[model samples]
Target: MSERETWASRAGFILAAVGSAVGLGNIWQFPFKTAQFGGASFLIVYLVAALGIGLPAILAEFIIGRKANLNTIDAFEKLGHKNWRIVGALGLFTGFWILSYYSVVGGWVLRYLGGSVTGAYFGAPAEYFGQISAGMDALVLHAVFMALVVGIVAAGIEDGIEKATKLMVPSIVVILGALAVFAFTLPGASAGYAYFLSPDFDALAANFTDIVPFAVGQAFFSLSIGMGAMITYASYIDGDQSLFGDGITIVFLNSFVGVLAGLVVLPLLFAQGIDPNTSGAGAVFISVAGAFGSLPAGQLIGVVFFGVVLIAALSSAISLLEVVVSWVIDNYDVSRPQVAVTLGGIIFLLGVPSAIDTAWLGWFDTLAYKFFLPVGVLGILIFVAWVYGAPAIDELMKGSGLGDGVGITWLWLARTLVIVAVVVTLALGLQTLFLGANPAIIPPL
Candidate 1:
């Protein structure tokens, strides 16, 4: 058997991890979610859930991966009960399911990027989106996006993921910061700032029950936990690194980027006299595009904005693809390149319906978000708090400079607070899916 790969450097691992966390959700979804749920008040609760529940859950996954030093399924199987492997399997499938639809969206971003350069969508953004959103062009773009991801993964870990992320992550930050700076220069920018920063205590109190679930889900989704991506990334780290510090850094960077994106998007929308409330899945091609088209420099700004999104999407897509590819290579005798091609092809095929049919795209998205994500996260919490038991603490404490007390407290929280939060996420997800009320209030396209 071949020797397992390791990250080239701590910075490389951190960048890769951060890249995985910051995706399309951060750019459009997070800001929209915060605005919908009372802005600053929602932000507070989200921070709590992210630090308390999301961070610890990521630590748990890191522990399992680093301690066992194996692929997702093998890590759980080796460290916990035999059946615990099923958790990894579920996570792998969830990642796969998400990436299938996610890639289709990535393709949409790519198309918009092209249209921005050509000024094709500038005339009638809605009609332009309708034309390209479905049919053969969308599928070809999806294939192109998948090809980028597959090519990167096939190059081996350190040489591909690490190198690509080291470049992509920093670029995303600079571009987003530039956009935000430009956004602030717009007239009426203060209104966007007020909407995002001002707290509404009464609104928060009244909507706590309804808002908490979505907050929890956002935290989970933002961190790329509940799926095998974090576990797979952690598996590549060397023993000397601090998972706790790295985990915190990842969360902080991801959160900062999400908020920064809001600063860019919200102000741009407000300046154009558009209601951000109407922005959903098509926030870029619709809301932001509407604003850009009216600007003298719309074509240039469009390139920068969509380019940042494309990089962010690709970074996250690579991690999701890696989870499945790692599993295949771990269980089979095939080479990494071969597995990347096969699995990439399969994922592309799975996403075909999404590219061709808007309803099918929505359904795939709903299924993954509602069921796969929450359930898979819940399973990880159970495995860490129960099956792994004392060893989980040992894994978390390594190089963390922390004592057993902190570790024990984390375990207790995971077994209690985190579990409760995840349960709420799962329940609300189900209710929204079947009841059609969507109390969790997810964003639309």
Candidate 2:
């Protein structure tokens, strides 16, 4: 077999990881979820869940990847726990399942970007979204988006995934930051800020059960924790970099983007008196499109905003594609380009149902996020804290500039709090799914 490829630098690895984390989940879904759940109350719980549960899960994946220096499934076998490969396989499957519908959403973002250029959606934002959100237009756009992702992954690690993300991640940050500043300048922006930044404890207390599951799910989704994206990316590391430091950096940057997205999206919505909570699946597209249409030079702003989303979507898509591509090339004697195209074609075909009907897309997304993600995360934590045992801690502390003490604390936390929290969240998610108790928390299509 050919030698394993490694990241060109520490920065490349971190940026690529961040690029995976900072996707449409953070920007597209977050604001709408916050609006629907409890505004800032949901945001507060999400932050707590992100740090408490999401961070340690990220470390667990990092340890697995850096130690094995192999694909996610092989990492388990390499570490002498062949049966535990099931955990990695679950993660790999989750990423694949997610990308099937995720590509459809990416296509919607691309359509909006073009519509912005021609002022197409400006006339009737909701109608425009209705027209293009699914069917043949969406299918074609999904093909285009998948093609871009395939080309990037086909280029291999250093040249394709890493190089593309370095540009995409930074562009996401810069453009979103500028948009956030502009969003704040709009009329009635203060209400959006208050809704986003000020938590309603009473509301949070009342909706504690309803809110926490979604918060935990959002944290996992936004941080790319449950999927093997982080694990695959970490496997490419060439040095004994601080996994904790890198994890922290990835979380911080990703959270920053999530918050910035809320700032830009909510303010834009409120400034135009659009109610985001009722906007359903097309919340971002419809509400933000209306907001832009009503604003001076709104078309230009729409172009730039959707452009950032397109880049973010591609960055995440490439990482998900790489999770599968990495596995194929590792096990078989196939070339990267061949695996990329073949897998990309298959994934595109898988997404066709979602492209043809958004209800199918919602079902795919809900299944992955509500069931697959938490299960994948729980499996990894159990493997790391129990199966891998002490070596997991040692892997974390390798170049982390920390001693054994920190590693032990993290391990115990993973064993107790993280695992328990995930279990509770998973139970709640399952209850919601089976009982249909609270359908609102089910992600919008």
Q: After superposition, how far is residue 232 of candidate 1 from its true place, in Å?
A: 0.5
Over the stretch 1-445, how does candidate 1's per-residue lDDT look in tens digits? 4678899899999999999999877885687777667777777887887888889899988988888778888887777577889999998998898888889989999999999999988888888888877889989999999999999999999999999999999999999999999999999888888877787889889887657766777777778998799999999888657888999999999889988988998788788887776534554567778889988999999999999999999889999999998888877788999899999999999999889976677677667767888899899999899777888888888898988898899899899988888888788778767775553234345
Best by TM-score: 2
Model 2 reaches what TM-score against the true structure?
Answer: 0.98
Q: After TM-score superposition, what is the CA distance of residue 135 in candidate 1 from its true location, in Å?
A: 1.6
Q: Write model 2 residue lDDT over 209-240, tens digit each, in one string.
A: 77887888889888887789989999999889
The lDDT values for all models are 0.85, 0.90
Clashing pairs in 2: none
lDDT of 2 at 242: 96
